[model samples]
Target: MKWGRKSMLVAAAAAMLATAACGSKAGDSGAPANEAGGAAKPGNAILATLGEGNDNLQGKKIALIMQFNEGAFSAQYVAGVKEQVESLGGTLQVQAAGNNLADMASKLDAAVNGGFDGILTDHGTAEALEAGVKKAVDKGIPVVAFDANLNVPGVTVLQQSDEEMSKQLLEKMKEDIGGKGNIVKVWVAGFAPMERRQISYKAFMDANPDIKEIAHFGTADKPALDTQNQMEAILKQYPNEGDISAVWASWDEFAKGATRAIQQAGRNEIKVYGIDMSDEDLQLIQDENSPWVASIAVDPKDIGRVQTRYLYQKLHGDQTDEKVVLEAVMVTRDALPKDKKINTTELGEYIEGWGKSEQGIADWMGRSDK
Candidate 1:
């Protein structure tokens, strides 16, 4: 169960074949314009173009079971899936397990027995949902997972390259802090992606012995509030400008909290780095006094659309990769709007790949071949 960097590389190289193209995303008019009179390309819009054969999806019943529905990321992901499913004339049954494995198990069972054509498990784990996934697969229901490593056969696992992402963020932190400093780590175990990222994190920490980890903590549920409280306590405990040189958060929510705490403590010297990007996360980075430096960006909406499209392909007898590992990029304060407020949709414009990865996948599937 130990996911090594070598395995991560192989999976990533294979998955890269699905997202190599770069161009205007699906719904964009591809016209040239500028921000001069506000007629520029709108970044905050649904980016995936629906496939032509939605008629095939008409009347098909699909189910999306989520492990938790706590943030804008989850909302956007479901919105992307709903857009695709409804456009294709299908009805999607949405259910949230609210971080309860038993609830996830029950939902999976219900979806299978209720005769759903396809099932999508979002942000779950194999230890919790494997049996349900296996039963659904055995019943011939096409199942695709987004960020869930459910080790069940015949299930397509879709996720971003977490290990590589962690490495990128940590490397950035190393550069920013001059390779050696007292750092705090925010993490929570039992999640698959977090576990993989932990491997990458440990490797980085071990490789750099001078970087002392002063404390470790994380938050869930009300992540923004809880993380802020935890970090504020950490700051109070350390209580010095350079005592805490940097903080490496496993995810953006934790980073946001840490950054807020640092800002409040007036410890601008402490830089915060993390994985995952959101509009709010970028807003923090855009703040002139913010301690957040950078993070790995993965558009949840794009991920939802891509996984759904891949599921569509699987249903239509198209052979797809067993695992679809997404490509992600680093987004810094430099890439965000300087003086104005921006949502995730608008924020995505600054990321290199943005909506293009799913478009590439759809293009490769010949969804636009007509």
Candidate 2:
């Protein structure tokens, strides 16, 4: 599912155009006056401008097409989108393609043909989604892509800064391993964010000669199995290589798979690190016998909310920056308070609430511009 070199070029160009055209002044209403002719404060003026725009989606319809809704992460994203769209007075129609590229294309066509006001998709591969995105754009539908590389023209991506996430994960790995280890990196294929993680990880490895990457491969859909298989094979090949200090995964599923393989083999010397703060992964981190030391958490609900706000602004003719990147922080089990425990449901709620907040939306829009 990897994009060919030509497709990559086209995607890059499309992304540049999409980002450049993100801003608009069409939706702005007259600024509110502060007592006759008094100048309005910056914050108040911003709020007034937003207020003047139509936030009601009472009759508007939104379509959300996911790469696949098989995992908790994808489910959380879809839930966030539905909740936010409803809160904004809109209806959300969701479709899952189960990782089938052709199915995604068909679903997107249906959404556009059905007159959905906006489309939200989880990008699986730049090339695979390109045709669908082009169709949506041709039909004047705005697209908000989540958790994938979106270099498509006229598309807005709602996801974390890939480079930043990778940097945080690598820094944490260095901290846990004391900057010395033979690491194996397993990444998600066809996902742009995971690709970026690999790029950043290579940079980190180059900077730290003490750390060596033994193997690097892609785990497209079955990330967990991919991780397990890759790790198992590596372990068998390097059965006596005691210097393997860590296993780095670009996603929690990969980390979990690696953990399972390592545990089965009774290798306690290897530490695991990854991104995506899934609840199950968090529990493992908290487990006394778990090998997971740290992870970078990007709240999917936050991503949904942010994308909604941006689409709202765009729909109403508001100016926005072309690319938005959110920050992620590394979480370590040792950093948790002694009395605190990981709560997956609570974390889900926290992200869900974000999708319902105007402020959250605004903040996300502001960040997206940069």
Candidate 3:
């Protein structure tokens, strides 16, 4: 994943078109923005689209505006978006909001007015995105939103089953801790998925009166590093065995941070459970004496691909659902492969119900876009 000089040049060239692409800082949204997952070259080199009716995506200019662009999950999701768009003969560029809500809102406005044929929005609040989404609808543009809390008509809202993800993670944590213990919660509010996941978190806290929350903390910016720093301090404060039972992370980044902090302190008694998983996460889970024990997540890449497919379907005048929720999967340390390292693609073999879904697939999509 090291970016050499050549890769940087390629990424810069690929992102040039997206300078004014989707989100706020990337263009004239009043702040400076950069492209997400711009470490690789774009796939506009060899573009082709084939199908019978309403399947033509070639030459379709697409924009992906993102408010959060960090971690392996986000990288894979961006990869999926880029790959799907390229496969279907469309061009895509990513615009980053740098975790700023106002910048994200401004990016939405830029995408609406930025001449993008289709738009893909990632992680913004309802208050900031509704008016801009409504504008896109008025202009007859198709939009596929990922974890953005917008109720605008004609905008396809896509996300993982947030409640289900939380439910599964919490259920496992409760079972592991015997339903009663002191635990820390790592989460941030305002993002659509985080908000929905909080629903179950709240319910879990209420339902389990014995499971007291010893500490609660999280942040959107540099989440893993920040969480590690904070967790280290928290560990010192509660410097005794059984003082903390487990750490429940709303996102994998937080889990990773807390895991490192816990492991470095040699707190083998403490465990970590989280939402979302990646190759790095899996590796950490399998690491000797690692504190990260379990996580629940949908395929991040599949989310992006499905989001792109929905956008293509909408642009083709096909009727689609207003809400699309991807299925979630739980991965525990016990379920991990013992002999080998498995990336996301090979995860389904070990974990049940962990593969791609046919949510936005259509007959017109065909086998190949060539």
Candidate 4:
């Protein structure tokens, strides 16, 4: 949890494994032109080649349960999963919960009873689904949690490392704001990863007294709305409080909402920061007129592919550790080379290459063990 040397070493190994496992099959052509940890231009050829060698997944049934089918961001993740599942020769049955815990529990139970070989779940309100997950494990089914958090005992892997991601976001925010500003924090309830992000942000705040959290939007089902309302309320109460300099939401939607409220209030001084590398957020950062500053890019497509690969390996008897945490890279428009703009079109291609490359797949597989 401290992210000490041991943690870094482990994370580094996982990253290596993820990179290596990207392209691992014959005639698989989506391998990125650049090496892992390197940069490459994005293109359609890359998307076409996504998940080439993942055919090893043939003849398997992978049940996917998403928190909600809404949002382009969520849709992309599901698309990524579908692509990987098909490439690996696995069949996918997707069910959406519409952000309802009861629906999620019912669907999860059906997946288990229907004899799904493996299960993929996006982190939601785990408390509501904890019992359901336990029941699945009781039936010898392995579950992979992505983007969200659930403390289910038999979870083959906990997909993302939120603490590290949060730290990266905070560091980027400080750099974007020139290292000193008052910040507001917001998060969603039962979304474990966001909770972890809040913890990391709190740590950063503790170390930097100058950066105080004036208000917090506690976790809720629709955290973006709650966060927006909180920001609006704060701006009204502190009308002239020029000290409020930044708004940090745990997710991009919340950040977007906060930005909207700030703009409506005619406060252009407050910068906005958050996670989830959503296209809208990226465009906002790219816009000269926008107050959006930076974000920690979490490639859901890549996360889906990696999660699938890990599950496949585990099913095939790979000796993986109990947890796999992927580190997210900080992304700012300023960080992009002037010659190389952020290529939204190339994201799928890059991820595809990462998923198909042999070394990339191996590297990602290794991360599970570490």
Candidate 5:
């Protein structure tokens, strides 16, 4: 993690307060420490002091810009951000780029011009946002990026540990397939997180020569339906137990399609391992007949809360790691809730630690202050 404390204006604008932000507290006998002074805490604990007593975040305007506004993941992520920002007494300014690169850039420019105190970019690539992010920084407006593969000098990049997630998913696939069989892969090129995961995929395949790729499927267009149709065709062509060992998908959407195809075709022998998850994913995995056995599930809401907290810290003059990669939890079919009453919005409630972050406490305390 690299830390680049920029202009004086940025430092002046920085602020922080947290009850349970991210990771454990630092500076105790048992807590770890480095030459720099404190060991980083996991989950939402901030061990180091970021210097308190700044103005509360109330009435501060924060802009959250995204490339797309659709999908379950997007909805949950937006919900998380809305909850955090509102709790922290900051007003949220939302912009949807509609998957247009130029529009994304324009929205960033708008946020800066509109004088938002902070900016958050979701799932954007460097090509689509570098200039705009640079502009925001130039204006002394701190910007935070979520899932954007950017190497910008001062922006904070928050993402999941994709390589480790990929490794776990692939290891599970290898176990199910006995380390050797015909496998299908669903992937896309150019997306940053997928690119990192692809590196792991390649390394895994190289180390295990026994696993052979019988077919290559890409999910660039009409993701779920396209993948489902393709998997159905493949299942028809190879209609034998153990003939197709497993299907590996880079994301849960592709995995959902593969699972559907397998279930429809009564291919009970095949299993799927995928990265990422949503409420729909949990529902499917809970099904006894689902081919999607496991996934590297992450709480999108938690991601939003964490990213928002990072912005809150930065706004309060708190020092943070340049890059924060959150670890993922392995979710399996058997571990899913037996009752199907839970709705998508309530999914986070079922998660181990969702809205109960130290950041939430900070927000409430700051608001209640006289």
Candidate 6:
């Protein structure tokens, strides 16, 4: 919960299993390069790589139940999943659980009993949805979790490499600030990814004594606005340049808020380092006078595509790994084009290892018409 103060040592140690993965995300290369995180579809071209389509996925029903649909990340992720399902001729129903834990649990239970052929969930805790997920598995329904912590048998869990992302971001933050200074942290605990990320933050803090944390505040509610309000208050408290060296935002919403606050306060002297990505986040980072420098994240759309593909694989009676982890890329302003705006689909050209993944590509799940 309180990840910043005294209880960070154990979390630091747990976060030490650093990821050693990098390459092109092959699965997302199926479609034509699309711009922006929104309105892009990773087409059927990837079907060329798979062996055959069972044709069983067509006409099947899918239920995508989410805990929240906030920001460009969630929207683009949902868009990817929807388009993937449609390309396979499957019907998808998305349920938004908002901010209520009970609502999240009930959505899973409803998906199970609602006669859907397969289910995909985004961002719910094992405590709230484990029983329902277990029940779904027992009922012979295929379930895939994106950024959720449930580890039920017969279910697949997919997540970005959080440890590596954090490691990448913080190392850069340290370098940007000359390896020592005060910073403010924005993050929340409870969600799986956030918890994983905190591990690296704690470890980084422990390793670098010169890097001092001056303030910390975060929330899942109206994350960007809340962070802006809090960060604005912190700016006023410190007011002078160099009083805060940088802000470490574990999520993009926090980064957006912090960057806005610092810019409004005319504090470009401070840098903002964060995790997660989106088109809007790109624009912010690319701003002429923006303080948001870098972000480490996987393409959110690819996350959805991978999750849905795994679900379809299960439907085709193919075996898939219980855990699917995608590689991450550090998108820096220097790496992006000065003249053109790009989306996750086109990021590979500018940022290395952007959309590369091999998780759900199956020999039995490509298009038969081809």
Give RMSD to native, each candidate: 9.5, 11.1, 8.5, 10.8, 12.7, 6.9
- Name the best candidate (by lDDT): 6
Q: Which stretches of candidate 2 lie over 4 Å from their true place?
A: 1-56, 151-153, 338-340, 344-360, 363-370
User: Order of all candidates by lDDT, from best down to worst?
Assistant: 6, 3, 1, 5, 2, 4
Query: Residue 350 of candidate 3: its Cα lDDT?
Result: 82
RMSD of 4: 10.8
The digit string of per-residue lDDT tens for model 3 on 292-358 reads: 9998988776777789888988877898888998888889889987777777667777887665555
**Cα shift from native, residue 164, model 4 (Å):** 1.7
Candidate 3 vs candidate 6: which has greater TM-score?
6
Q: What is the lDDT of residue 279 in candidate 5?
A: 62
Model 5: per-residue Cα lDDT over 237-304, one tens digit each:
99989889998888776787789999999997899988777667767777877888888855766677
- Residue 10 error for model 4, in Å? 36
For model 4, how does the per-residue alpha-carbon lDDT over 306-336 read when each residue is reduced to its tens digit?
Answer: 6766666655545555577765666665654
Q: Flag the better candidate by TM-score, 1 or 3.
A: 3
After superposition of all CA atoms, the RMSD between model 6 and the true structure is 6.9
| lDDT by candidate, in order shown | 0.67, 0.60, 0.74, 0.58, 0.66, 0.74
lDDT of model 6 at position 251: 87
Q: Indicate the TM-score of model 2.
A: 0.76
Write the residue-wise lDDT of candidate 6 on 147-200 in tens digits. 777778888999888988898899999988999999999876666887788899
Report the lDDT tens digits of candidate 2 across residue range 111-172. Answer: 77887888877665566677878888887778777666657766777667778878888888
Candidate 6 similarity to native, TM-score: 0.87
TM-scores for every candidate against the unseen true structure: 0.82, 0.76, 0.85, 0.74, 0.79, 0.87
* Candidate topping TM-score: 6
Candidate 1 lDDT over 6-56, as tens digits, reads 223332322211110011111111111111011212244343334565456
